[model samples]
Target: MTDKIRGSIGPDGPPWPVDLLADLHAGVLEPNRAADVRARVGDDPEARAVLAALDAVRTDLGALRDAPAPPMPDHLAARLDAALAEEARRAFGGAPSRPRPPRPAGRR
Candidate 1:
């Protein structure tokens, strides 16, 4: 996740600003407020760049949301499985009798 945010793997590369997630998330929560924030960002070069990076991230996320699921690396899949197991344990008061498979990739 850090590598992906740092642009080490995906397009947009490292130096891609991750701050856009906050802005985009804000937009998701309150579109009018997001519009106000976006206007402010337009006045600052750095802000604009961050917004652009976020737009790229949003685009990629959207593509994933729209596409079919794909295979995931073993480590990541295992990590997700473990987290879900923890969550399930917390919810159920006991370990999952059996480990469940990882969720499909792509968007939720």
Candidate 2:
């Protein structure tokens, strides 16, 4: 269970969204919805195969051991942090900070 979403090809329609199948596979979908998808997969060979393939991939991916995450490059990390801060400020309707004007020498 990585947070990856799995998609499914519907019997006659376009593919269903990833979360629908992922939730069903994870047993998190409401029982009725899970049963509906299960029934559809059971009734249609192509749909069943699609579900199986997605399941297989999920199983394979889950079996992989996680490697230690390396440190982010300082430059990239700084840029990312700055971008996120800017985005948050904008989201909260805050303007960017302005530099203060230089004071005259006579002013203590």
Candidate 3:
């Protein structure tokens, strides 16, 4: 079958595979990503509309990102921490603590 007939069309060109979409979703979840997406909201009316929709999505995701990350009630954090500690111990044979990589300078 032809590419178009096979539903391979996308706005820019060919369709994106599921894995690519997942990776993109993860990247957009990063801190300050909403601001980055907002910066793309441009001058053209059509682009502005698209940007507006993106802005709505960004807002929802921002809410999710900003939601209370503190320990939940009923000592849930302790339970979770213990469970994760056990898993990490089993998986790595020790407490798992990975260093956060430094953010890039002025790359945002």
* Per-model TM values vs. the true structure: 0.37, 0.40, 0.29
User: What lDDT does each candidate get?
Assistant: 0.59, 0.61, 0.48
Q: Candidate 2, overall lDDT? A: 0.61
lDDT of 1 by residue, 1-108 (tens): 353443543322234334443545446636765665555545556445766766788899999999966667767777777888888788989646466565566533
Ranking by TM-score: 2, 1, 3
- Candidate 1 residue 66 Cα shift, in angstroms, is 2.1
- List model 2 lDDT by residue over 10-69, tens digit each: 422335444555566779977987887777556556456666878898878876746555
CA deviation > 4 Å runs, candidate 1 = 1-21, 28-36, 71-108
Name the top TM-score candidate: 2
Q: What is residue 17's positional error in candidate 3, in angstroms? A: 13
Worst 10 residues of 2 by lDDT: 3-12
Question: Taking the tens digit of each residue's C-alpha lDDT, what string does model 3 give over 1-108?
Answer: 233322544423224223323333446544564344334333335445544555688889899998966435444545666677778878889656553344344321
Error of 2 at 20 (Å): 3.2
Q: Count the backbone clashes (under 3 Å) in each candidate.
A: 3, 0, 0
What local lDDT score does residue 94 receive in model 3, on the 0 to 100 scale? Answer: 65
